[model samples]
Target: MTTKVLLASADERTLERLSQVLAEADAIELVQVVREAANVEDALTRHPDVDVLVVDELIDSGRGLGVARTVGAANPLLGIVMLVDQAGPEQFAAAMESGARSVLSRTSSLAEVVSRLESVAHWVGAARSAVSADARSGRAGRVVAVAGAKGGVGASAVALLMAQSLVSSRTVGLVDFDLQSGDLAAYLGVHTRRSVVDLVDIAGEMTGRILRETSYDVPGGIRLLSAPNDGERGEEMTARAARSVVNALRYQYEVSIIDVGSHLTEATAAVLEEADVAVLVVTPDLPALRAARRTLAMWERLVVRQRSAVRVLLNRQHRRNEVTESLAAKIVESRVDATVPDGGSPFESAMNTASVAAASGPAHTAAAKFAAAVVGPVDDGPVDAVEEAYAEVAGRGRRRARGNDAGQSAVELPVAFAVALMVLLLAGQGLVWGTGYLLARNAAHEGARTVGLQAWGPSTPGAARADALDELSGRWRSAATVDVSPSDVTVHVVAPTVVPGVRLTSSVSAPVQREH
Candidate 1:
């Protein structure tokens, strides 16, 4: 990004010299000159892209401090330069209090002034990049925030995977804002000495160069801004610095993903508010669902009319007779955009190797849907159909929930059909057992008759009984026994049970008679 600068000074000589010096730098473009402090506001308004404000300490008849303070307060990311005749402790303090990064001697060589300007320009560009489009103009990076309703809910995994999905199409930045217990780095099997904490610590000297240095590349194409390696350093990062770093990331990447782990922090609110799609990743569990309800409620209460961007995502889903995605969403009073299948052995292998798994099926589909919620099509290819369907249902549900007949929508056809299918399967199993038992009984009776007839026929009773038992054995292979005597024949059979280690039995017999 080319840095835009507004040079303000009462003296034409100062303006001319500064303009000439800034013009010499390829990275900076002099937007306009502010002749007076009163004109500073108008100049910035006229050139909204101006990132740095260069003003003489004596500008506006010695009101430079007031102007710098006022402008700095409005645009915290803007870099301010104080031109001093002689630098001193008092002067430096005043300059900084007024939001200047550093003070440079007025009589400093053109080289020094140019160098200072370059530094300011870099920070200005970074600051400009940091803000979302909703916060500022010229940048349109889509921000997606993945936060857990509770710890260990896979928010970091969701965030990393979502970012990875977008990498094929756009530059992505994945930030670990979990702070205290950030395990995002561990998930990817990569570690970095520098982190977002480091960026925030040097906020005063923050520039594009500094911000880029703190980011580390992971196995996936996405760049990672991890939490501090030393857990104690989390508290050291302040909200203001985090804000700056976020804005810089917004400008630098096409999509920015933030993993704000379970607990709500001072900085988490800002990221959530700025995100285009703020996803609350939770499992279909009581604790996580409860936390999700609390978090979403709090967002509504705090942000006021800004909850539209919020989405609830269920992760690490497993097939259970009792758990359903719709139920979880209903309990949380939100829509479930997607249910990510459990990572399973693939994820476990990745964990062991410190790398990402090429997880297909549900995991891949969920990540693709997640990416589509906040970003455009991948590589100009179609967005995931599942995401499109999720989006459609969510829109309809919201509209239906708002209308007078909201309760009518509760009978969701899909959920109803799922329940119906389960019922059908259970009923079908009963029929299977009934038919098997009936057939077994008939076969046993037929066997008994054959032996009973033979006992009165030309063949010997033992041969007839053996033949009957063999026929019964083939027809009803489950289990069977036969007994024959001069006057009667009896047969017993056992059928397989629906469940393991259980069986169903049937019995039949016939009386012996003269050959008929």
Candidate 2:
């Protein structure tokens, strides 16, 4: 467990002092000492086992921090401690931004320097051990890359929920690989101090512990590696860094969902290269489909990923969308894997609340299906964890929408009637109400099913709801209201009782059948 140290300083006196101090410290081995910033790289190359790099503030004609950045990028596992004349806030921030893990004043006592070295050594030791353990396990997780044809296409939502859905059976990692202008942190309502940029430097030695340290452990069993809040720092995540980070994620988590954002860059292209399942999210519109085609072609020409390897997902699609899935697939020259119905208000509300699980209605259902498509299908034996989570939240919301009237009857019968007569009337009313609820629910499902079965022409939701209502009895039809969409149908029935204004309401939702 000895920590190998490399000492780099332009000042002879500083170098001698630090080398002698580190060499004398227990469990610290001074493997290399260099007097120039330029020579540090060679020293590290010669001593690959070196864990810590102690650099002076003015090395190689005042390029000390520059050298720190270079070596840090080259050897991510190498702990960096910068020695400066003044360890002020500015100096410390500069050192950290340059990839130095810690900052120390040259005037500090040897004891303080040793304490700092040991602290850094502990982190490096744990990180290296985690990496070693992961390598030994020989486990590689699946990578799913989600790219948007254009902005505002709900690609980020898809990526976020996709990760959410997989958490039932596996450890999922959601990476905001968009680098510049990435908003996963904002979407999740989390502000992470460390980001993907932190891992870009240490990606080669990334482990579960390191990933956890640099990522925000979300509430629902997801680890999110956010993009840099400062958009300018995104340039640090180069193609090589992206590849290394994605590979390390694969070794650490059971599944990783990468949101590559709308614009494709070298870093994002690197992610696409590592993806086992690559999807381009596009709305059912001519402009989006054209953009998707161009993006696929660019990916092909750049040799980042093959066009055929990418699957197209239609977002914000309507039953009578101008661009059909088949037409869009033909336009993009890729298979349209699935379509997500326009979620309308509930979906928007969930996004605003930063809770994907709170989303109800057709959008949530479609998101679960999309996750299943990417990560394999969900079993029918039991309630799926993702679906169950959504349903639970939706149920709570619905309950809140209704008053706390549990254990109370919807209608109160008069005490003036005979007991037997009242019981019989109440029983009859209950039967009628129950029958009406069932009929309305069945009609809603029928509406969705009929809309899905249409192939020859566009089937509007209005027509579908009307046709389904026609199948119900006149009494039930008069009291039922229906709403239909490509993803599902919802129906609400108000069963009237003998007393005026005394009624019972029942709402039901069913999935809309469609051609897969």
Q: Which stretches of candidate 2 lie over 4 Å from their true place?
A: 1-138, 377-516
Q: Mind giving the per-residue lDDT tens digits that candidate 2 earns over 1-516?
A: 687888888798887777777767788888877887767766876787888889887987888887887677556667899999989999987886566779988877778887888888776664455344434433457789999998888899888877877787887999998888889887788878888988765655454546766888788888899998899998888886788788778757778999999888888988898888898999988888899999989989999888878888899899877788899889988888888889887778778888765445787678778888777653323422223333444466455535444545545322222453555556546544544554565566567656777752455777778766754643567778887767777888876665677868777666655766
**Model 1 stretches astray by more than 4 angstroms:** 1-139, 304-306, 357-361, 378-516
For candidate 1, list the clashing residue pairs, or say none: 129-251, 130-247, 130-248
Candidate 1, position 486, lDDT: 65
What's the lDDT for all of these models? 0.68, 0.76
Cα error of candidate 1 at position 288, Å: 1.1
Per-prediction TM-score: 0.51, 0.49
The most accurate candidate by TM-score is 1
In model 2, which range of ten residues has the least summed lDDT? Answer: 379-388
Per-residue alpha-carbon lDDT of candidate 1 for residues 300-384, written as tens digits (9 for 90 to 100): 8877214456777888888962568988978888888788888788776775675663444568677778677657654343332
- Global local distance difference test of model 1: 0.68
